[model samples]
Target: MEQVPLNPSRYPTVDYEEVMNSDEGVRKWTDNIYRWGFSLVDGSPATPEATEKLLERIAFIRHTHYGGFWDFTSDLSMKDMAYTTQELGAHTDTTYFTEPAGLQMFHVLSHTGGSGGASLLVDGFAAAQTLYREDPDAYNSLKTVLVNAHASGNEDVCIQPAAPFPILSHHPVTKELCRVQWNIEDRAARMDVDAATLVKWYDAARKFNEVLKRESMERWFQLKPGSPMIFDNWRMLHGRSEFTGKRRVCGAYINRDDFISRYLLLNKGREEVLGKI
Candidate 1:
């Protein structure tokens, strides 16, 4: 089966109350992510504890240097740029990890005395597919070239993958596009390729970046109180616009394997779902 990019105008949004109270609602919410890569739960409580509980219902929270569940404001609380008022380019998180986070949730608690903090999402699968169809050379470069990424914001703490990985990854058996890892900020500068290959890689990567930033490939929305958004980190690249004022956000990362396991069990007996994995 082929994967089509989401219809931007039709992004799923289910009621939080429904999800918390009914099994069918939970299946709908998770199914939306399985089919479209993201979904939103409206009417959720806008608090760190509430967010944590909601995420636990879906999968286990992945703990990193920042802890399992986090509540932070744009006050430079951490060494990462996400702590400041700046425009973050669209990219996936935890690129430095050998197994990057599977899913991410974000619920904006408050944004006062500020203007723009719109959330941005670009379907990496769509962009990569376009690259594959239009420029095979560039697509192949990204799929084959191995690169490094890291997280060194904490004092005396720098973490990176045990080995370098490629930007585009496919399923081993199905040969279907499964994961995408392209973070300009987190990607390290080191490479082992020759000068010619390096030049080709950069050119290819630049082209892919252009595709990712195209207007048709991007979706911009303001994450509001009572609306918690969850997205497949492996397929969607997320970012935020430059913002002012105090913006507090609460969220957590759910392990990929745990999420898939939940998705599989919830949709059991459906061959279409069970056969894919």
Candidate 2:
């Protein structure tokens, strides 16, 4: 199905219980997530048990070198910006990995007394598609430009020296828009290309970013305590606002294949059950 980024007013919050217990709920949630790149889950508890059950309801957890589930609080030693008090612009996480986490979950266990700490989400795929439609040359340039991303350090090594990959890539089998990979924080500064193409690449990047920040495409909401959200990491770009006060978040990541598999299985099961009736 062709997906587009929509205003959150269209599909606000989804009930957590239905998604956990009802087959139809699973299908609808899957469809909504894939279509909109996100769904805010409000009916689930903000506990580890609830998060674990939610993952089980959809798909199993994806274990990486970062481990299964995460409990994050602001700290000086934070390797990632998600654990800091500073504001972040819209971007995908773990771009350094060869295949970054395809899905992300964030459970707000406690967000009391926090001001200016609301979370932001944007549809990166929508921005890319807009570029493709309006500026074909820039869109093609983005797909052709190869950039290096690194995620290794003293004790950990995922892809040493990084690997060169396109900012935009289509599925090999389906030849459909499969990945939109861009992370300014993780991007290697050494633009390993001729001057002319490098200029085009930057120009494309500017266009994409401009669309991503348009006010009409934004969804702003405060993540109060006990509200957990699950979103597609591949298609959506998320960010955070700077805040003062305590904020604790917990959740896990799931593989892209497993998510798609679960979605397919659930849809099939529903179809089969309905057909029998």
Candidate 3:
């Protein structure tokens, strides 16, 4: 795979300037993203321009129903809890969409006042592995059972119908862990499987959620302004703690394939050394 799995003890950080300026920066940052499914870019300019410029390094920003790139805060108009002070549980975004976002990038424009709103991320692959080893039966159910998800109430912004996807999905060929679809808020009733066995799937989901929430499995960090966080939407579950005062963030999503394609092209030569390993 040529990817280094994450070591939870140490946080991963890359230089924003380096990624925007140097070729080696592109290789290093992309490699880290491939390895960890997430990476932090420190020392970014606290401006909208920085966010746009940064995304360009990988590919064009993905224009979805949410718009290409936008800034969001405690705006009452938002249809989602993310715009409010509520603490969000660890979950993946856009689970209702058949082709959900592939990569998401966030640049904290500002975070002030009461001490909270720290970012939370759980390694889905790691959590899935834990489930496989500890409760193979539950893991099997999650890997095969289809769950329903829906998105609506934002008017023309989004009115997606409920979609079905296995909670534990893998790469079509590699059989590698791909995405963990776990969103409590967007989850609808499960009607994809036989009613008699539905309870078993729910039990598996509960156990998976328990593993995801285990204190040791989560990574929490206060992403203050000038710090940009980019993560694989498919491989990592993200959420935030409740906070007071102003907290604004600007970000966007890039198509998953585009991001992967860019990385493969930029790091093509470097693989010879990795191949030797």
| Local distance difference test, candidate 2 | 0.77
**Each prediction's RMSD to truth:** 2.3, 3.6, 3.4
- Model 2 stretches with alpha carbons more than 4 Å out: 1-12, 152-163, 269-277
In terms of lDDT, the best-performing candidate is 1
- Which 10 residues in a row give candidate 2 its minimum summed lDDT? 153-162
* Window of ten residues with lowest summed lDDT in model 1: 1-10
Candidate 2 matches the true fold with a TM-score of 0.87
- Every model's TM-score: 0.94, 0.87, 0.91
Best by TM-score: 1
lDDT of 2 by residue, 1-277 (tens): 4644354455546778888889778787776677668877767877878877887777888876566887777774446677689998888877777778889988878866757877888777778878888899988988888888865542555443346788888888887788877678777777789999999999988988888889865667677566677789988888888988887888898888888767766766757746755
Return the candidate ranking by TM-score, descending.
1, 3, 2
lDDT of 1 by residue, 161-247 (tens): 999998999898898889999799889999989999999999999999999889888888888988889999999999999998889
Give candidate 1's total backbone clashes.
0
lDDT of 3 at 204: 92
